[model samples]
Target: MTTNEHINSGEWPLWEIFIRSRQGLDHKHVGSLHAVDAQMAIENARDVYTRRMEGVSIWVVESKHIHASNPADAEAFYDPANDKAYRHPTFYNLPDELKHM
Candidate 1:
């Protein structure tokens, strides 16, 4: 398969895709598959993952390139802060007439 054209055509590595079904919600990891290029990856992800209800947007990243932190560093990775009130906008009273965030 090394020197063959057929195998060479399928050389592009696999990728994992994430999809955002709607606004205001975090992107969720959908699944993974192979493609010849990035554009094909997106199209393939749509045909494979979202053939039914579908999503608003899609993201495709090479599965081999994803770097994740060790789970053993959980405490140091995501620690809660005591004075993070400013990070949240809950105290501000937004207009009730507004339809979207």
Candidate 2:
């Protein structure tokens, strides 16, 4: 069914899918799909996104539950970090023996 049809029919809620590749340490948003619940969403994600078995893990969350900061508010939201110079690694002095750092 088309997206509009699904919405109008109240079939299922949209879910956001995230996949963690076998070689990756973090899960990244892949795409979205409509599912009846979280369990179905994960299963559907595996079938749709991991057809090549490239992903080691899958995460599915209801789209409505995902909240994000607006890009227009980025300047105000992240401005506080700019004033904290001490938070930068360059602000600290590393010992000569700390080669790994």
Candidate 3:
């Protein structure tokens, strides 16, 4: 059967997987997979993504739970931030000894 048929047939739901590599500080989206539940999704992600023993942690989130901003509304959505110069680090003056700053 086609992918749509499988999904509509009450089969496993799609899950988005994020993996934190051993050397990484944050989890990055690796790929997606279909699983019965969250527990199964994590296990499946480990097997599929961490087979090479590269990942230190795995996060599985249901596709439906993810909410993202619309690309078409980018200007309107982020325009407010541009006016708030204080929110940016460059707006402030730092001491000369603050090497990182």
Which residue pairs clash in candidate 3? none
State candidate 1's TM-score. 0.57
Model 2 bad stretches (over 4 Å): 1-8, 79-86
Candidate 1 positional error at 64, Å: 2.0
TM-score against truth, every candidate: 0.57, 0.77, 0.74
Please write out the lDDT profile of model 2 over residues 19-74, one tens digit for every residue.
99999999999999978777889999989999998699999988878899899998
lDDT by residue for model 1 (35-61), tens: 766798899999998888658788999
- lDDT, candidate 3, at 73: 98
Worst 10 residues of 1 by lDDT: 1-10
- Tell me how far the alpha carbon of residue 61 in candidate 3 is from the true structure, in angstroms, after superposition: 0.9
The residue pairs that clash in candidate 1, if any, are: none
Model 2, global lDDT: 0.88
| Structure candidate 2, residue pairs in collision | none
Angstrom error of the Cα, residue 5, model 1: value is 12
Candidate 3 residue-wise lDDT, 1-101, digit = tens: 44456567978788999999989999999999998778989999989999998799999998878999899999999997987888877867788888954
